[model samples]
Target: MSLIPSESMRPHQENVIGSTQLQFDQGSQPRLRVVTHTAKSILVRFGIVGLARQWPSSQRQATILRYHSVSSAGDYRSPTISVHPEMFRRQMEFLSRHYDVLTLDELVSGLETGSLPPKAVAITFDDGYKDNATEALPILARYNLPATFFVTSDAVLGKSAFWTGWLHRAVSSASEETLRKASDSLIGGMSSVLSREKIYAALASQVDHAHGSKRQQRFLALSRAFHHMPPLSSPSDFMMDIDDLRALLSAGMTIGAHTATHKVLAGLPEDDAREELSRSKQELEQALVTPIVHFAYPNGHVASNVDDAAIRLTREAGYRSGGTSRRGAALVGTPTHNLPRQGINDALGFSGFVFKLEEARFSLLLRGS
Candidate 1:
């Protein structure tokens, strides 16, 4: 399970109200989602977040936003990994207008010196998506915001396609019946009733834990199974090439290593985990001809995809900092090797973005009440 909260499962209600009032409140949207979005919008509009930031404790904490693809043509297998360009632009504009947007390095430095600014945020992208360069970079440059791109080294080398993209294309292209048949042949028979999301999860879970070479073999086998299916609707270059990395550097963006093959580090042996970290850093450094100082766990859910072993190996492998999918703010005393990050995606619209920036605080108040 991911550390990030599921929007569908989370409920939001404001004030004690009767069924009639609740019906009125719900309007056209789903009751929980409408209430949640409305509640968050109200909080932001009413200066509640601003007032919260006045607290000394709030001032000491900073946010790092994690993103993957930024394009309208998003991944069919995982909508949460993609944010539409327009929404992303609006988010960048909001960050520029309301927060002190800093690079990951700067935010880490502030944490070290205990000098983090109020409302400080850092932007990051994982998986080296081509859309990061094609879509996100222009918007970021428009806002003059700096972000770190953590590229899986194998993807950049073109030795193999990013497994997630390959998986996305294969899974999205096929029908439900086709998927079940393929799953039976490749792994085992999946339940016919399994939804696309569950099927994707089942397949991804398999891919995520495998060794790099084995992972590729599995992905290729899966791809071949779906070969008769029509291609992805929005087929494009999924991963960044070496030149794209150079372009990001020239355009004033930071490059970091996401690991050699983007395997879940916690599942691997210590030596394998260490190799994933060190080798990716070595390869990225060699390719970019610059030091790769930062790292991010592949699945990055603390204690699940990430653990003490993974964190220790990250430090041993010579990373200055490591980002995770653990959902919280990075406080002054937070571990440098296991910094918490909030994942941002399409489902989290502008209102959701506002809420997520201060989600830790909001969740605390909600829980306490």
Candidate 2:
């Protein structure tokens, strides 16, 4: 009567049947009752399991992969944020095996019209790190993949107002105790167990204020108090120089502006915001000899801390599109003003990367349906 067999019955159905027959001989009526109940229970369990397995709820989604740098261990504080060149090659190889990789422009066009292909992915890099030229470009070329690099123009040209350089040095040079004291000094009696990761997040939250002259000066002073160590013998030792940018341009990668001094656009006055956006765009175009059409916010979050004026400024500055670190696939009809991209860290291995791509695609399918 039952559809599912017990574990004991799994190996030999004939043996279970033979044993039940033998038990029945000793007590006919009771044996019949037991068999009836057992069979009915198995039938119900089997039916439920079959129905659950047959139901359609295990499909995957699509997502884009965004990276910051692919560099040597010496250059990066977080290995997850910076994929090694070999790992980068492997990741791309895995992607090529399973998905259709799209260029930035193709993905943007598809998103504008709502016509993305199945299992499509786009790759992006941020910050224009020098190692991007030294490490990432060769690997990308091997796979014939095109990527967009968002450059903070002042940083690319070796200027010092960008907070990342100071932040990196602070994180690299300070002992755990010194970093703790610095955090306490800035935020006033905060806990001491804060890691560099947490400190970076806290500092990023306040970087929007760097657009204001007074606030910017205040932050610079605070950084000096906390992070300024003996200046590196050469400032260009840490960042990509102008010649490095030229090498990137020559390699067929597109460069997008990430603001002049990497200040959060929304936190600055309208005039200052305009200057950051316009000047960065103009500088990059002049350096690269091409129209720089895309932009990314310095910290990439505009929800709570950044103001709408920044977005307005970018549009007015003539950028064709901008990106944010929101986890979603680029879709047709997605606003050019607030395109969402997935921020990838090293923790996302080949399997994790594949799964995220599926997740983004699945969301798009659901939207279409």
Highest-TM-score candidate: 1
lDDT score, candidate 2 = 0.62
lDDT (CA) per prediction: 0.77, 0.62
Clashes of each: 0, 17
Q: Pick the candidate with the highest lDDT.
A: 1
Give the distance in Å from residue 225's predicted Cα in candidate 2 to where it truly belongs: 2.2
- In the range 47-155, model 1's lDDT, one tens digit per residue, is 6545545554556789899999898885532786889999999999988998899988899999999998977899999989988999999999999999999988887
* TM-score between model 2 and native: 0.75
Query: What are the runs in model 1 whose C-alpha is more than 4 Å off?
Result: 1-35, 75-77, 175-177, 186-191, 211-217, 220-224, 228-236, 361-369
RMSD of each: 7.7, 14.2
Q: Residue 95 CA error for candidate 2 (Å)?
A: 2.7
Candidate 1 — what's its lDDT? 0.77
My TM-score estimates for the predictions, one after another, are: 0.83, 0.75
